[model samples]
Target: MIRLAVVGVGKMGLSHLSILGAHPQVRIEAVCDTSGYLLDVLGKYTGVTGYSDYEKMLERADLDAVVIATPTRAHATMVRAALERGLHVFCEKPLTLRSEDSEALARLAEERGLHCQVGYHNRFVAAFSEVKRLLELGAIGEVTHALAEAYGPVVLRPKGGTWRSRSAEGGGCLYDYAAHPLDLLAWYLGEPRAVGGTVMGRIFSADTEDEVYSTLFYPGGASAQLSVNWSDESFRKMTTRITLTGTAGRIVVDRQECQVYLRDTAVPPEGYHHGWNVRYTTELTPPVWFYLRGEEYSAEWAYFVDAVAGEPADGAAAGVNSFASAAVTDRVIEMLVADAAVPCGVAAASGTGASGAGVSGAAGAGPGSRGARKRAFWSLGKLRGE
Candidate 1:
């Protein structure tokens, strides 16, 4: 069995614990958290040891790998400690608040010859995976533009203060929510060369932004737009959608389905037609041993475990969700943060009109002079932790 330890017993941490515990190839060697009460409760139920100190658990558990679900600020330190002790690591998204730290961790993992998977579970979603496959096969030809959006009711109110509202703790809709779509964009298209026309707004949260809008320009002239909001009550839960426009066709993907539209009568892949085709995720998603929010969660852990067990000393299999990939996503975040710093009027004056001129106004607002001023002021603040 692959012995494992889990740090941080918060929401995402507990989810990882449950899935890892259920895996037949894994043994829950220990769990760590600051809350004694939480440790006691989980220890009693899982029959696993618990510790208030992660270092103590690391010393005693004899673990082969660790899953880190701690707050953003704690990731670099915790991951460094675990890697130093020769443990494979599965860290949640935004591997670190900064790209340099993520690069350091990636290099460390390479030097140690250990598996390091970042938790961008959206990549494991069946439809998204299939979309990747199609893109690789040139299903839509050379991508010219793309759009990614995510919305949810995560921070509907400002009263219930949590770490998510504070930028220092990795709170904020940008890192916590928009990171998903941003990562998806980078994965589908190439890394962005430049970013401009950003809008970050606070609808409810006192400190963190509740909404984000940005435009990204890729090396090959392909461009992307990202829109995310955690204060949208219309979304019962988090919803992610991506649209890619290419030379030959276009593809659209949401949680439930992936739809493709071909501009010409070109031959298509199996289960797809030339004019228009739709594939439901229910028909495409693979089964997992356990399911929580989505099968992708369990699937990502399973992939990480397999990589830990089977990866060669060269660490080739680590590329799928590797820290390297997370670092690239971190770079995109860095660009977005930088773009948000520019004055809205300055961006528009430079011809980088919000999300491309005539495509969409900032945050669904019109091009009115008053709206432009509001958008400019809103985009000025730095993302808290950055």
Candidate 2:
């Protein structure tokens, strides 16, 4: 059995703990949290050792791996410590607030030859996975443009006291919410070379943005538009949707279904055909032992467990959610921040002349030219609390 520990028993952390604890091949060794009361409360139900300090737990518990669901800021430190002790790691998304730190941690995991996975659970969703397969099979045919969007009622009021409201801590909507669709876009389409037309707006959060809109330009002239909002009550919970437009057809995917529309008759994979076709996720996804929130959560954990056991089947697809993949998402976050730094007026003015050089210069100003804006955007919520 793989002896495992969990750090930071928050919402996501608890979810990981539930799935990992239920895995027959896993033994719940220990759990750590900054709150002694929380540790006490959880220890009673889990029947596992608990510690208030992560380092103490690491030193005392005999563990083969750790699942980290700490805040974005603490991810780098916790991951480094886990990797230093030769433990496999499963960390939540937005691996780190900065791209450089994410790159460094990725390198550390690679040098140690450890299996590290990020919490991009969407990739495991049947509909999303099917979309990836279709794209690989050229179902859409040279995707020219894509739209990725996520909306939910997460923070409708001012979250002045929460870490999520602080950019330095949780990275606002871009890292917390938009990361999902952005990661999906990067996975389907290649990494974006440049990002522009960025806008971050604070609809509810006192500091961090609750809505983010941007455009990503890929290498082969392909482009993607991203829109995310955590304050949209129209969605009962977080809902992500992707629409891809290609030379021959278009594909749309959401939690429940995958729909394809072909302009001209074309051969598609089995169960799909020309004209308009729809496939429900229930038909394409395999069964899972347990289901909570979504089957993807359990599916991802199953994959991680198999990866830890050195199972060849999972090893082949191990890199699907590896840290290296997350690092690319981090880079996109960086690009968005840089793009947001450019003044709205400047962007508008550059677009007026329609000169390539003028627009490029405006977009190239990046984070270096407007670091203060980025800082202010991240710190506004925290400052409100102070």
Candidate 3:
């Protein structure tokens, strides 16, 4: 059995603990968090050791892997400590608030041959997974344009916001909410060449943007638009969707289903037809050992467990949801951040009557300058590797 520990028994952490606790190949080694009461309660009832101090737990616990569900600010240090201890790590999403930190951790994990998985659970969603498959099968050949969106009722009438609303702590619609679709965009299309028309607006939260909108320019004439709003009460919960239009066909997908349309010239995949095909997520998803918030949640953990057990990944088409991929998503966020810093383009702002022209002189990152930044980002060695 693989010895495992869980840090930060928060909502997501507890869910992971519950799911992994039922895994036949995993042994609960220790649990750590700042709450002594929670630790005592767990230790007393669960027959598992608990510690209030993370460092102390790291020093005392014997483990093969760790699932870190700590706050965003604490992730870099905690993950570094775990990696230094020669333990594989499973970290919650947006691997780090900074791209450089994520790149560093990914490099360290690569050098050590340790599996470091990020918790981008949507990748495990069957409909989303099918998008990856269909794309690989050339169902939608040579995508020309795409739309990625995520909406939620998160910050409708924000009171004192939690760590999620603070930009410094990796909160905000851009990082906390938009990261979901942004990561999906990165997975579907490669890293964007540049970003423009970015609007990081705050609806209720004072510290961070409650909504995000941006345009991502990709290579080979393909482009994408990102639209996200966490303050949208129209959606009861967070909803993510992607729409792709290609030379051969089009695809639109959400958690529930994947809709595809193929041109007559396009050759359909095995189960798909030339006109239109719809595949529900329920039919695409396989059963998981433990069900939590969704099968995607447990499915992600199962992927991590299999990685720790040295099993081959689901397939190269599914891709490895590692720190490397998260870093790419971070870089895309960084691009959007830089783009939003430049003043919005208004026709009245310039005599040329061009809306694309911004007010900033040399201080702003425009399309040309941002593409150079993307080149530097892509220059990083094997940022897409295992």
Best by lDDT: 3
**Model 3: worst 10 consecutive residues (lDDT sum):** 377-386
**Tens-digit lDDT track of model 3 for 283-362:** 99998888888999878877888888988867732446889999999888877886676544333344645455544323
Model 1 lDDT per residue over 1-386, tens place? 89998898899998998888899999998999999999889878878899999888888889899999988999999999999999999998889998889999999999999989999988888888778888987888899999999999888776546777798888899999999998888788867766777889999888888999988888878899899999999999999999999988999998789999977745587777778889888998878899988988987887888778884422212367789999989887876776676544423444655654432245536453456545543442333232
Better of 1 and 2 by TM-score: 2
Model 2 scores a TM of 0.89
Each model's lDDT: 0.84, 0.84, 0.85
On TM-score, the leading prediction is: 3
lDDT of 2 at 229: 93
Q: What shift in Å separates residue 57 of candidate 1 from its native position after superposition?
A: 1.6
Candidates' TM-scores?
0.88, 0.89, 0.90
- Clash pairs detected, candidate 2: 207-381
Better of 1 and 3 by lDDT: 3
With candidate 1 superimposed using the best TM-score fit, by how many Å does residue 255's alpha carbon deviate from the native?
1.9
The global Cα lDDT (0 to 1) of model 1 is 0.84
Q: Weakest 10 consecutive residues, lDDT, candidate 2?
A: 377-386
Q: Which stretches of candidate 2 lie over 4 Å from their true place?
A: 314-318, 346-386
Instruction: Order candidates by TM-score, high to low.
Output: 3, 2, 1
